[model samples]
Target: MKFIGYQSLITIVCYLFFIFMSFWCIQDLHLERHLKMHEMQGKLLIVILSIVSGYLLSSFVLSLMDSLRDLIYIFKS
Candidate 1:
């Protein structure tokens, strides 16, 4: 995969690592919340928003990289 060059692979790995860490942090935060219903709801919302935003940003970046790679290939050929 042309897009999977050494630097890009490293970046992808780092992105995955960040995703994993975010999930872990979300879980830990939820576990720390008290039994209060309102508190739980707020925390859940924050976690969901964080995850969704991260995913959207990552997808955008990956798509941009793919487009750039295709352009480079076209020029090379």
Candidate 2:
């Protein structure tokens, strides 16, 4: 597959992973009451934004790695 396709797959996987982890943590810590309180106060957007930001951050890191690899290769020649 092309780079774009691979990047998109990675982004989606990362997004899902973040969402899954957040839910797992909330449940594991028995924070249901806190979650309900936040939800009632309309703070769910914070969670959603965090997931999206995590995905974006991963993408940026991946891009940086690619750039660094290219630079290393250039220096190796």
Candidate 3:
């Protein structure tokens, strides 16, 4: 029970961390030339892309960790 709660907390933290990192990384890109519309739209696009890519990255990492942990069961009785 407590372990599950800790896992959930870790998952949330990992997701937020990755999303923040992605947003920071994406901010460095000069994408103004690509957007013909308002500047706000470009920023919005960056936010959307950051969330998407971050979620994907975090999910991949967490799943990989879980898979590796599961391998221990195979070696056990």
Tens digits of lDDT, candidate 2, 3-76: 88987887678667766665555434434354565543434555555566666666676677679868987878
Q: Give me the candidate number with maximum TM-score.
A: 3
TM-score of each model, paired residue for residue: 0.54, 0.46, 0.91
Question: For residues 1-77, could you state the per-residue lDDT of candidate 1 as single tens digits?
Answer: 67459767766775676566666666665543554457667677657756765666676777787788789877787
CA lDDT of each prediction against the hidden true structure: 0.66, 0.63, 0.89
List per-candidate RMSD values in Å: 5.9, 4.2, 1.1
For model 1, give the RMSD to the true fold. Answer: 5.9
Off by over 4 Å in 1: 1-37
Error of 1 at 21 (Å): 10
List the lowest-lDDT window of 10 residues for candidate 3.
29-38
- Sorting all predicted structures by lDDT, with the top scorer first, yields 3, 1, 2
Clashes of each: 0, 0, 0
